[model samples]
Target: MNLEPMAGFLTFWAWWVAALVLAAVETVAPGAFMLWLGIAAGLTGFVTLATGLGWEGQLAVFAILAIVSVLWGRKWAKRHQGSGPSSVSRRADQLPGRAVVLVEPILHGTGRAELDDTVWLVTGPDAPAGTVMRIVRTEGATLIVEHIG
Candidate 1:
């Protein structure tokens, strides 16, 4: 079968299939790399259908698009690093600055306190019962605290 006349159709279909496969992989594994490549492949398939490029040219276009997409993704990731908290996600890190009465005196830098009905292992200077302290930060499962007065 002479595929010469049908070259454009074949190339477009091949890239379309590749794009779908890559997109599915990205959806399942979610490494962020495959999504860009899938987008590139989809664009390449469109370009091949419109321009009727030969195999070599189609491959080149796909490769170039893949590289460009990957580079753009990296640049975007770097720019958005640690931007802010998401509304959909939980905010366990927002406990700092919340005032809580020390349930037990902090001795040798370790004690216990109750916050929001949860008992937390606290670390700070020694104080007697009923001393108020502010949460400084959390270290692992322990809450670091400081005396308020």
Candidate 2:
């Protein structure tokens, strides 16, 4: 008898489902792309409720929402996020600046040294055992070195 409003409601439901599913996917992936898509869908549904746009206009609105969300998200990430050091890597970095003694002399730019009874895997500048070395840098669980000679 009368299905136009019912159809509109169904379209609204479609938008809601799409938004929810995309949001859930975003939660699992944690990259923000799908999250933005979900926001777009939800916004499109909201606009549809207020404006009751035709199907083509609804699609256009969805596209605009997605594009804006992604662009905004990118800007937000750049400002608020960083390639800052993680806890473990920062600890390893702290090691290199410390003092260590050459328990094994560096020969040909490779050797072992001791720092607080833990042997430091070292590199750079040959130095005899009993000589002191300083951490120049770190290389993957190994400490690069500079010989005091």
Candidate 3:
């Protein structure tokens, strides 16, 4: 209820400590979201220490920095999209342009194929088993393929 005794510990260094803890947790967690939050906390700590902002002002600065950092991070991610691993999450996205033999004949633009030792539902023109095909794209869980030669 009473936070007066903790006032001494709630100075600018407190933000730096919080930032370090958040960054450490981010390393052990999923997604890169917390990294940005930690950056905001660190920035807030720096500003608070330099300008001696009050607790309310420090919190306002943290919120603003967090929002701006997340927005910038999202924009940066979009700009760098597809530049990293092809299959960042969806395993099927890694199959495009990969050649695979038809495990089951495609009938009515749908069939099955094997890739990386995994059988997958595929959509393409009619092709018999043993027909080599190149995966072109994907719709849902189905791999879109085209006959190769």
Candidates in order, TM-scores: namely 0.78, 0.71, 0.56
Compute the lDDT of residue 19 as modeled in candidate 1. 96
**2-98: candidate 3 lDDT, tens digit per residue:** 8754453467778888889989999999877888898999999888877777789998999999999888877888788745665657776667889
Alpha-carbon deviation at 28 in model 1, angstroms: 2.4
Q: Evaluate model 1: give its lDDT.
A: 0.86
Global lDDT scores for all candidate models: 0.86, 0.84, 0.84
* Better by TM-score, candidate 3 or 1: 1
In model 2, residue pairs whose N, Cα or C atoms come closer than 3 Å (at least 3 residues apart or on different chains), thus clashing, are 96-135
What is the alpha-carbon lDDT for the whole of candidate 3? 0.84
Which portions of model 2 miss their true places by more than 4 Å? 1-9, 83-96, 114-118, 128-132, 139-142, 147-149
Collision count of model 1: 0
Candidate number achieving the greatest lDDT relative to the actual structure: 1
Candidates 1 and 2, the one with greater TM-score? 1
- In the order shown, the candidates' Cα RMSDs to the true structure are 3.5, 3.6, 6.1
Task: For candidate 2, write residues 59-95 as lDDT tens digits.
Answer: 9999999999999988887778755756665788677
